[model samples]
Target chain A: MHYTVKTAGDQSIIIYFGEQISKQTSQTVQKLSNIIESSGIIGVEEVILGYTTILIHYAPTRISFHTLINTIKAIIMDVDLAKTDERNTIEIPVLYGEELGPDLANVARLNNLSEQEVIKLHTEPDYTVYFLGFSPGFPFLGGLDERIATPRLENPRKKVQAGSVGIANHQTGIYPVTSPGGWQIIGHTPIPLFNPSDDNPFLLSPGDIITFKPITKIEYDEIINSQI
Target chain B: MIHIFNVIKPGLLTTVQDLGRKGYQKYGLSVSGAVDYYAHRIANILVGNQDNAATLEVTMIGPTLKVLETRKIAITGADLTPYVNNSPVPLWRSFTVSEGDILSFQGYRSGCRAYIAVAGGLDVEETLGSKSTDLISEIGGHHGRRLIKGDTITANAVHTNKICLSRRLSTELIPTYTKHVRVRIILGPQDDAFTAKGIETFLSSEYTVTKDSNRMGCRLEGPTIEHKNGADILSEGMFMGAIQVPQNGQPILFLSGRPSVGGYTKIGGVITVDLPKVAQLKPNDRVSIEKVTLDEAHELLYKQENIFKLLQASIGEGGGL
Candidate 1:
């Protein structure tokens, strides 16, 4: 856990763990973010993880800048990097094709594979959640099969429904809330990654593992109806 | 006393806002709040509310409301020609309105937004420890959207407050809303991504705020800022005041509703002291970007934090208005 504290703005400071976006850098950033978040240190408002950095927003009046830097430095040393990595694997149930996934057929055609082959390749790997960004609770997942890689839509959709699982190039992800995107949607999941009303608003965190489980439309409807 | 006001007509875009939502940016949720934080603070101070209290943020146009029983209310930032029962009330000061008195705004005066602060904050449900409205996400504040006709606002009156009601801000402290502003910035966490010539072009060129600009960001049109490589980078954390230059060379100055992370290279970030000026800028406003140091930005911020405290002391003790 060695890092550098760089200038962000007047109200915040950034901790750069490494220069590149690697799993080691991500783990280090996540560890510090978690420590600062749980520290309950007055004046520290937020702790967000980037590829290899942590942007900490602190209130000047509550805690002075000089003191905040000192607090962070002390906390950074407390992060035991040698400890066993903590991982939480969440299974997201997805229903492939039909109205929910309009781009599924297009993706299969582009990849030169049948729709069944595309689904099989997609559901195989255990994707790693690098971070949550772009939109609320939208996970930036890594680890997609190269054979099923597809290009994004040239003209972005005006409205992509929530829970839509999309593939863009080598990246595959799920949209937690309804937002306009250009990803090549292949399927949709009924599980909500973001529920603002709940005490824990986001379902996934950095370093978490996720696997897509193929489910029928009836199962999706049952899960959706049960939640409601 | 619970003072309530019924909305007769909502303005172009009026919504309840406070300081902003914090701690949720990690989840990619926006930190929506008052754009002009300085003005928001002044209005709150005049009405004896906390700086973080929820106030109605009136945009380009203004709102019309029928006042019921209420405590002293203050209108600050962007004059907007606010009136009480056809009588024009001055901005930057607190005033009392009687029951059945109609409060409305006429004309687009100076500045782009205004804040209305009640003696006690508007009673709104808190989401993620904030009362601000996030229109994009549709969460928090008066159903998480702009105020519509027939909507009602209720504030729990704080009767035991000691601050005088007839207080007014001195002329020297009021921020001048200008069409052209030169904002100071601190060169960035990703400035290395840009070439030397690109950095030079950014500092020398004058930019105009485009129409596409909104609460999320101010999209500027200016000379192309050359980059050493491509414009895209590994997505990183972003905050308000971050000046991100996309492939087209133009910059986007992020505002209150900025995303938590972005993939573009950020050349610099506006200083804390100048963000209020950026917030008040209207579309097509011309701007000049200047560079400042980290130490200088911090110094200005520490000085600004004392403005409200100094204003509070200048007001007289409690009295019958």
Candidate 2:
């Protein structure tokens, strides 16, 4: 559990667990995040977990940067990476092919597989939520089946609608909001990934497990219409 | 009762802002707030409002607001040359406007943005515990967007104290904006990713703020920082004042509206004390970064906070007007 801490400014410090992204690395990052969060250190505002880093934003007036660093260092020294917490598993219903996923055929063509095979491969493995980024509630997922791994579109779309599930290279994620992006679209999810009015705005968090369940177009319509 | 102001002209990018939403960045929510926090605080202080009271953050151009009710207000930050009923009003001071009085600006004068704080703050529905607008996500502020013509904004009911109306910030306390601004910064979470020469280029180079700059970030067109390895890193949480260098080598200085996380390598982050100066800078302004230790950054912040305390004390003594 080797790590390095660097000062972002007077009030924030970024703790890098490892250089690259891996489940093992992310687990350590999440554990440290959980510990620091529950520590109740005064002036500690928020602990934001990334793929392999934890950014701690604090109030310098309440706690000195040096003192906060010492407290974090002491906490990290005693942390056991093997300690795991119960995480929530979320099932997302996605509609594949045709208008729902305009680039599904292209993905199948690029991977030299039928549309059914691509869909089967995408759903087989349970992907891990690396972190939420790019847009609100948008998850950056890992553990995409390499067999269906395809490059992103050379030119990104001007606007990608919310609930559009996409893949870029070896990663797969759902677009929680409508934003201009470069990922290759594969399907559309009926569930709202983000709702500002809800008690919990995001459906997923770091260290959560996500499994995409394929559904027919009529089922997607039924889900969408039922929500309204 | 709704104390409202009708918008005659909404300026370029007028939006309601406060101290910003907190404890929600982990959900990928941005902590959108007033960019010029120093000015924002002063404006609120002048009108005897709480520090986090919502105010209108006016950009280069100023909005034309028609008073629907008599209200006490204060203007701070950029000198947009605001006038009430065709008569000019002073900056960094509190004043009262009567019913039917129209407030408008002449044009851009000094800084890039200004803060207009009413006595009770702009009464807008708070989203995620903040009145500040997240322009990217379109979630908060006045309908989660910028002010436009025909928009009517309400001010919360406040009992005005005549004594506070005489308040004015001392001349020395008001900040001045210039084309060439020197900002202090503390080097990196990923400074090692760059070569010594790259670090030198970043510190020594004079970067001009590009038009592409916005609340999200200030894109600088200057010397290309040579990366020791590739510029991309695994996406990590980003903070305000982060100097992120993309693959093209151009540096983008993240501000209040920056995303929760990013993948580009950041060389360093600007000290909190100097962010107001960065906020006041307009496009085409020349900015030079000065490297300072984290201790110095903390000391500077402490000094600024002390000055604020002094200002509050002086007002209590009835010295300022």
**Which candidate comes out best when scored by DockQ?**
2
List model 1 lDDT by residue over A1-228, tens digit each: 567886666677888876776667777777778888999999998887787788888877678888999999998877788775779999999999999988999999998999999999999999888888888888887789999888889999999999999999878999888989999998999999888799998999888999999999999999999998
Q: For this target, which candidate reaches the highest lDDT against the unseen true structure?
A: 2
Which residue runs does candidate 1 get wrong by more than 4 Å?
Answer: A1-4, A61-67, A70-74, B1-3, B160-164, B312-316, B319-321
Per-candidate iRMS values, in order, are 1.4, 1.0
RMSD of 1: 2.2
TM-score of each: 0.95, 0.98
TM-score of chain A of each: 0.90, 0.97
Tens digits of per-residue lDDT for model 2, A1-228: 588888876678899887887899888887888889999999999987898899999999899877898999999999877768888888999999878699999999999999999999999988888778778888888889999998999999999989999889989999988999988999999999998888888889888999999999899999999999
Clashing pairs in 1: none
lDDT of 1 by residue, B103-209 (tens): 99989878888999888889898998999999888899899888999988878666655323567777888888988999999988778889999999999989998
Q: List ranges where model 2 is wrong by over 4 Å.
A: B162-164, B313-321
How is the predicted docking of candidate 1 categorized under the CAPRI scheme?
medium
